[model samples]
Target: MTGFDSHLFEGRTVVVTGAGRGIGAAVAAAFLHCGASVIAHAGRDLSHAEGDLLSRVPSAARSRLVLLTEDLAAPDGGAQLADQVLARTGVIDVLVNNAGTMGGRIRAGEETAETYDHVLDLNIRSVVALTGCLLPALRASEQASIVNTVSISARAGGSAGSALYAGTKAFVSGWTKTLAKELAPDGIRVNAVSPGTIMTDFHRRYSTPEKLEATAAAIPLKRLGMADDCAPAYVFLAAGSLSGYVTGQVLEVNGGQLMP
Candidate 1:
């Protein structure tokens, strides 16, 4: 059904972090297409243009697409971003903590303290801080939802990237459940999307197609996930009727690779 007819998120405002590309970008586009005003965010590189993200959002939704840039790992970065979003949108109904970075090019002990700190800061701390920073705005809404991006590596311990990377995402999965309960009384819902072997830029730079395909074949679905394929789950989580009763949960979008 058209978003207007469904009223899934007719007048809602959503902020999607790391929205310049990949799954983040796709999720933002899906929300905008479905009638939610969206804030497209990015960190450092490509934060300004958000080329691919801008291209995907239909012109009709452009007015609702606000591009933002911030370093979420920094102490006040999350609060700063929230202020900017609030200044423009007035109220935030949904938050998708999709910003993250991998511990690229590392070996055991070769991973420096700086790199380890960076990974944890960007992947874990930011997710928590951003959510917390935006909580006040979210509380004002009648229906509020927060979706955090997780990974199979977080569950399996490690597949690609450094061990620290996996650990950070695992934290998100764990926090989502507890946070859901903590915020339930406040009328807010928290959930996560743990993606497995998706075809993203990072996956390509680290794991080759052959390796990814092999991994996908192992799954019952027999294919790695695409960014577009993962978008709907974000929509579902934000759609109160679709996920109103759902909170403190992790929806694994993996192709049955790590069935739990």
Candidate 2:
């Protein structure tokens, strides 16, 4: 079977959370294209994710892609997903923790405890729990990679109403570095990708047309990014053949929006 890079990860297995939409979908497709057996974990509902995925891939690669439906927001969801994966396959070579929500731009003064709890549990807690549950599976692989999807908001502190979302991403960035150190000895590299103003539903819900123009003007690239632009960063980090020496770092995919 031929993959994008001609079987770059012919025998690898990857789990991509939030694979039903946007960046997550793109990343999962990229892995499948490159010959990785992918467990595409879609949250809450499957919707048409499986059909959407098949539309973007070749028939040969279709068998390698497994659609896993689960609610990662549930308390036991992460463990359940991990168990399901291990039951199907003995090893997981890459873990892409990409499921997240912008939480719809509530002002700091207007944010409720309920809102805060939901954001933390889905964005932070679920990521940690899932990784913990899958450590053994990852350890079994010869090359293990964890790619956490951070955001340009993490470094820039977000726009007016997204402080909480930005804060959670900052925690992700810090945790990436620390976790990298802890896993380095195990040969399990941890890294993050910080995407800038990608034109996804994230901005469709929170950003106005005027706001988008201002953001585009501020960037040296003079335009907003597509979901595809950010997908390669995840693939790069996951392919140890490409980034084996790289770890504990954040790769910014912001089109020069923020130099850091």
TM for every model, in the order presented, reads 0.92, 0.95
CA lDDT of 177 in candidate 2?
A: 99
Candidate 2 colliding pairs: 4-33
How many residue pairs clash (N, CA or C atoms closer than 3 angstroms) in each of the candidate models, in the order given?
0, 1
C-alpha lDDT values of all predictions: 0.81, 0.87
* Model 1 Cα shift for residue 227 (angstroms): 0.4
Question: lDDT: which candidate is best?
Answer: 2
Residues 60-154, candidate 1: write the lDDT tens digits.
Answer: 77898888888876756677777777787657899999988685856667888788877888888777777887888899999999999998888
In candidate 1, the residue pairs with backbone N, CA or C atoms under 3 Å apart (3 or more residues apart, or in different chains) clash, namely none
How far off is residue 133 in model 2, in Å? 0.4
Count of backbone collisions within predicted model 1: 0
- Where model 2 places Cα greater than 4 Å from the true spot, the runs are 1-3, 48-52
Query: What's the C-alpha lDDT at position 243 in model 2?
Result: 99
